[model samples]
Target: MSDAVEGGARRRGRDETEEERADRMWQELIQEVRVAQMGVQILFGFLLTVVFTEKYDDLTNTDQTIYLVTVVLGACATGALIGPVSLHRIVSGRRVKPQAVRLASRLTLLGLALLLATTTASLLLILRVATHNGFVPYLVAGVVGWYLLCWLVLPLWTRYRHTSE
Candidate 1:
């Protein structure tokens, strides 16, 4: 057990070996991934079914292209979100939980970024189809801004603001 410093202060709950820290981080990351994975899976499933709907054929060429891109992004995001489980299963009993946790965290972050892009693309397609307004892009951008604020900015802000000066 040892103290770890961050921004000049010893981080709380730092009294753990590498393995124990990795185990704790793995548990926490899995819990977080569960929520995100479910959302991505559900969204990807819905996207998969959209092509079979009768209304899909009425989409403009541009809209169809956007839909295609959105669906691909959704699939990629789902893969990244679900990657940690597969990674863990394969790496189990290999004495690599710490490295595994690091890689899984990276995958989760990439998944989140992809999810954000997919959501933005989906909203743009839907709003364009529904309203056909010139302002659709702006509206979609605003929603993306809101998502960024909620998902990343607030957390980063809290982390920065609370850190020792």
Candidate 2:
């Protein structure tokens, strides 16, 4: 940390005002949220229609329960992902952009977790119904590993590898 960094002239190689940094970060966060929000909302919408399908009645009790949990997770994810917009709207002129960004980032992380659970549960339910075999769980677990590698591990590795002090 240098005086130049603290003086708000430069941070992590970007030279900008505090307000400009906040605005840029806010825009970046919004773009990321839009990507995740669309995904979670569409998944939630599809989950909502599952119970109305004629084939839904054929699901076993266990599968029905899984579907119920998945739908709930999807709903939770949708709410968490959309929460930032409402938060920003309510606090728009409060001069709290920094705090708002932190809170919104947390909400996005929580939403991603919920989305992961929803996706895993939905896959479990679907594979169970489609295969009706003991191997379905193992298959789902492998796919979950893939999701973790793609979604979490790669990003972390990149960050760790490229970050400068």
Candidate 3:
């Protein structure tokens, strides 16, 4: 809130201009997106092949529905994760880096959330098909809890504990 201006441009703790900050943030976001994008793309690719497998026909109706939903979620996550690259390509040299960065960040977050849902659904379908046991939901819940702890809770806690603003 107390950022000061230098050479007519407001400076943050890093003393960088708005353009510099946007560039730095854009690089970091792209790196993060690359990692997530690769994983999601691979997952989505595999999900696409599921229907061609012989085992797919053996799945119960509910399992088939789950599989369908998982594949759709995975596709959506892939699109969202890749959206920043497309956005950057289309908006390059437009002097809208800051706005683009904000939109890309939001897309990345949405992609991550969708990825979680897709993975959870896939796991549920796989376990149900593989085990056909009663404790599958409990097992899936535990794994989901682990994912939430690792993906969401710890990051939030760290941010809350260490962030000054």
Candidate 4:
């Protein structure tokens, strides 16, 4: 085992060299990104089609603004989620897999955060249009809370609790 692998080893099962660890992590990260990417793409596509609808013309100015912002956020999330592929393609065979993986991971996290915001805004817009109820904000807030719990809080908790210090 390399000294670096033995010294600051954080993996659960086996000690691995930095390159090996990076490769494994890259694969795992790509898998996660794939799942997230699919959802975001679908959501973004749906958002794109809304602008052409007759109901879009009847929307209040405020609602239109919200829809525009949501669409922008969805676009950003899509870009961020798809960034890793471009990063990999540009840096292929450069012996920078570790750095690439780290950057890609960061991008994926940012993408997910944006996706959460986009979904919240989309939900709020849809609910407002559908019901015009005062409870739309509350409903969106509840769903956002659920998303935070499932996507961010639980993952961090698991990492903190299970990983060695």
lDDT of each: 0.94, 0.91, 0.94, 0.94
Which stretches in model 1 have alpha-carbon errors above 4 Å? 1-11
Worst 10 residues of 4 by lDDT: 1-10
Q: Per-residue lDDT tens digits of candidate 1, residues 1-165?
A: 356798998765567789999999999999999999888888889889999999999999999999999999999999999999999999999999999999999999999999999999999999999999999999999999999999999999998998554
TM-score of 4: 0.92
What lDDT score goes with residue 9 in model 3? 90
**Candidate 2 C-alpha lDDT tens digits along 1-165:** 233556665555567788888898899999999999999888889889989999899999999999999999999999999999999999999999989999999999999999999999988998898889999999999999999999899999998998755
Candidate 3: where are CA atoms >4 Å away?
1-12
- Superposed on all Cα atoms, the candidates' RMSDs to the truth, in angstroms, are 3.2, 3.5, 3.9, 3.4
lDDT of 3: 0.94
Each prediction's TM-score versus the true structure: 0.91, 0.90, 0.91, 0.92
Say which prediction, candidate 2 or candidate 4, comes out ahead on lDDT.
4
lDDT by residue for model 3 (1-165), tens: 368888999765776799999999999999999999988988899999999999999888999999999999999999999999999999999999999999999999999999999889989988998899999999999999999999999999998997766
Distance from true location, Cα of 93 in model 3, Å: 0.6
Q: Which residues of candidate 2, in runs, are more than 4 Å off? A: 1-12
Flag clash pairs in model 3: none
With a 3 Å backbone cut-off (N, CA, C), the pairs that clash in candidate 2 are none
